[model samples]
Structure formats: C-alpha cells, structure tokens
Target: MKSLNHRTKVVILTAVMFVLLVAVYACGILISEEAVTGSFLNAKRPPCLEHPFGTDALGRDLFLRTLKGLSVSITVGLVASLISAVIAVLVGIAAANGSKWVDALINWIIDLVMSVPHTILIILISFALGRGLKGLLMGIAATHWCSLARLIRGEVLQLRSQQYVAVSRKLGKSSGWILTNHLLPHLVPQFFVGLILMFPHAILHEASISFLGFGLPPEQPAIGIILSESMRYLSTGMWWIAVLPGLTLVLIVLLIDKFGDHLRMILDPYSAQE
Candidate 1:
C-alpha cells in the first residue's frame, strides 16, 4: 500500500509539473494579442473584474503583460539551462576521463568560474556582449554550468572505478565507446536533475539583468522591465503595478524550483524505495 501510495504521489507530481511547464510555455501565445495593444483611456486602472491585474500607465493589461513576460523568461530559461547542461556534461566527461594534467586544468577552470560572484560575472558577460537577449542568454548559459559540471565529474569518476567499467576497459573498448555505453547512461539522472535545477536560476538572473537595464530592451515587457517601470509610479499609490508582477515572478520561480526537487526525489532510487 505504501508502494502504491508512493507511485500515486509520483504520478500526481509528474502531471502537475507537466501542466505547469505547458502553461508557462504557452503563456505568450495565450496573452500576446491583448498584451501588444493598449489604450491610454484605461490607463492606471486598479485591479478589478475588467482588468484583473490592473492596467499599466499606458493602459496595457498588467495580467497579459505579466503572462507574456513570464513566457519570454521561461523560454530564455529553457534554452540557457539546456545549453548549460550540455556544456557541463561535456566538460565533466573530459575532466573525468582526460589525463591528470587535463583534469587539473579543467578543475582549475571550474574553481575559477565558481569563485567569482555569479551576478557580477553575469553582468560583466552581458555588458561585454552588448546587453540584449543574446548577451543575457550567453551570460546565463556560461555562468550556470560550473556546479553541474562538478557534480557530473564526480559521478563519472565514481562510475569509472566500478567493476563493470573496469571489465569494459579490459575488453578493449575505446574510451569513447566506454563513455557512450557506460558512463553516459549512468549520468542521465544527474544530468536531468541538474538541468531542471538550473532553470529557476536562469530565469531569476535574466529578470535581474533586465531590471538593471543590461538585459532585454525596455520595449520588452519582461518582469524586470515591468518592475523597473513601476518604480516611477510607486509614490502615487500604484503599488499593484510592481507587487503583482513581482509576486508572479517569484511564484513561477518557486514552482520551477519545487518541480526540480520533486523530480529529483522521484528519480532517485533510494528516495523512491523509501
């Protein structure tokens, strides 16, 4: 009965996660038409039945704009996290299987990258790349891989010492063959968890950079941009302008992070057994 309960819980969590992901991805499509058009006459309206999340200074529907921004953020997070995950997997494999000198060099690189503050490094990278969507994506993809790489490297190193792996080495299998056939399969769980874990970080960083005016342009209705724009109206009692969007962003990030945790729990053999 306990086992059945566990399975049911896992299934429910999986369904919830799937629905959340689909909703996030489809937010742009669902809200794009309304978000693109605004009316000055309806401007600065408070949250009500007609404008559930209120209207911006330009009379744009805050709810639609928020949804659109979240959709963009989710897209950026998905792409950046996938890129970071791939880079981590490749670097991790190289670090684990390469010569001692190569391993040392990769380890040093990882340490150097991780030693710096992520926000500072990301800002510098984004600035250097000219501060737009491209720069933001690059900054996020480049900075978020070190921890995942280290995790993968450690996992691969441990897998390499296993009896089955040793037997494969003795069977005249090439290094590439052993990696593809043995190491890669074993690293799937770590890779997936790491990838999902990176998503919230990517989204938050993207919003931060945009808020600081170093990410997506002002024309883009990103959460950061929304919050930044809302600053001018705060003294006039337009609190919902900032509060609603900011809370929504936080809620999305929390959901993604929780999803990652749940996924990790479901995928971990020990956790499943427990």
Candidate 2:
C-alpha cells in the first residue's frame, strides 16, 4: 500500500466506499414491511438499545423506516440520473455535430431550462404530471441535464478538431461511425463522472419535492415524507424523528459526492499522473 501511487490509493478507497454504499442500498431494499410495522405499545419511544433510532408516533421503528425511505430515495435518484445522462449525451452530441443554427437552438433551450429555479420547476412539472413517482422522475430527469449536456457538447466540438478525427473523416468514415468509434469512447469518463455527480442532486431534489408534497404519495416510505410528517412531532420534543434520518441522507449524499470526486481524479489523465 505504501508503494501505491496516489491514483491507485484513490481507486482502492473509492472501491471501498462503493461497496459500502451498495450495502446500504441493499439493506434498505431487503428490509421487510414487518420490520417497520407499528404498534401502540412501542409508540414514541426515545432512542434505545432495542430500537436504535427509536419509535415514531405510530410505533414504527425509525431505524428500519429510515432505511426503507433511503432505499426509495436511492432508487429514484438512480433512475432519474440515468435518464438525465442519456438525454445529456444525445443532446450534447446533436448540438456539437449539427449545423450552427442547430447548436444555437439547443444552447437556448439549455439556458431556458437552467434559468428556472429547480425546486419550483420540479414542483410545477410534478403537479402537471399528476404528482406521483412518474411525475417526480420526469421532473428530476428533465431539469438535471443542462450542465452535463453543455459539457458533452463542448467536449465533442474539441474532439472534432483533433487530427485523428480529421484523419478518420478523410478516410471516408460516416459521422455515426466516427461518433461510435472515437467520440463516444473518449466521452466514457465524462459520462460516468457526470452521472455519479448528478446522483446527489437527483436524490436531494426528489426529497425536496416530496417534502413539499409534490413528489411522492403519502403512503410511500420516502425520506421526504418521513421528514414532512416529523414536523408536527418536533414541537413535542421528538427531535430524533427527523434529525437521525435527515443526517443519514446527508451522510449518504456526502459519501457519494466524495466517491465521485475521487473517481474523477483517478479517471482524469493529468490528475492521475500526480
């Protein structure tokens, strides 16, 4: 380990974090409904050895419930980020490869989307789409692609000016062939890093919209819904109800962000050399 390069060490660390994150998500998914079922006898208990996160007003174990909520949030984030990344890649390629007029039009659309406040826009979109899982997914996916699309577009333009690309064009390679053989391969790093970074934003937005009552339904076990319901109990000194779960969400986001940053460092040629 002492002989390892900085990039190698980062890769090892990132792998460990990735495993840890996967475990958390898996744990949440594996938890059963029975684990979080409520009973009046156990209601409103403060944190204890038996129930680490304590019980809520309905007597459900906050720990299990929180895990379940986190699982839901992670699922939403994964799906939304994937869709956004696809959109970003396609739009980016189009803007970079198409006519000047086409590029201008795409840029204008990106700017228009970015100009809106994300939370407000998500809320409006969610409401319009009927305010459930589908609505939230669409809203988050739609709003999160602008910056990444711009990055891909710029990268494609730069790649187009490269000697190898010009040589490929001279060899009579079709545009689609060049895109698949050259452009897309070079874009793998940017695509993955962008996707990872988008996750935190997606998760946060999902929580935010849900908390505002415009994302998921009340019946679903979501962090946003958990936080929203905890409001009334906070006045009664049930601080643990919201605090622990919220902290968990923050910690997960920070972990994911750290993983993305380290992975980016390892993948970047210049940074890896250092």
Choose the strongest candidate by lDDT.
2
- TM-scores for every candidate against the unseen true structure: 0.96, 0.98
lDDT of 2: 0.95
lDDT of 1 at 212: 88
What overall lDDT, based on C-alpha atoms, would model 1 receive against the true structure? 0.90
lDDT of each: 0.90, 0.95
Once model 2 is optimally superposed onto the true structure by TM-score, how far is the C-alpha of residue 165 displaced, in angstroms? 1.0
Most TM-score-accurate candidate:
2
Tens-digit lDDT track of model 2 for 1-274: 9999888899999999999999999999999999888999999999999999998999999999999999999999999999999999999999999999999999999999999999999999999999999999999999999999999999999999999999999999999999999999999899999999999999999998999899999989899999999999999999999999999999999999999999889889998586
User: What residue pairs are clashing in model 2?
Assistant: none
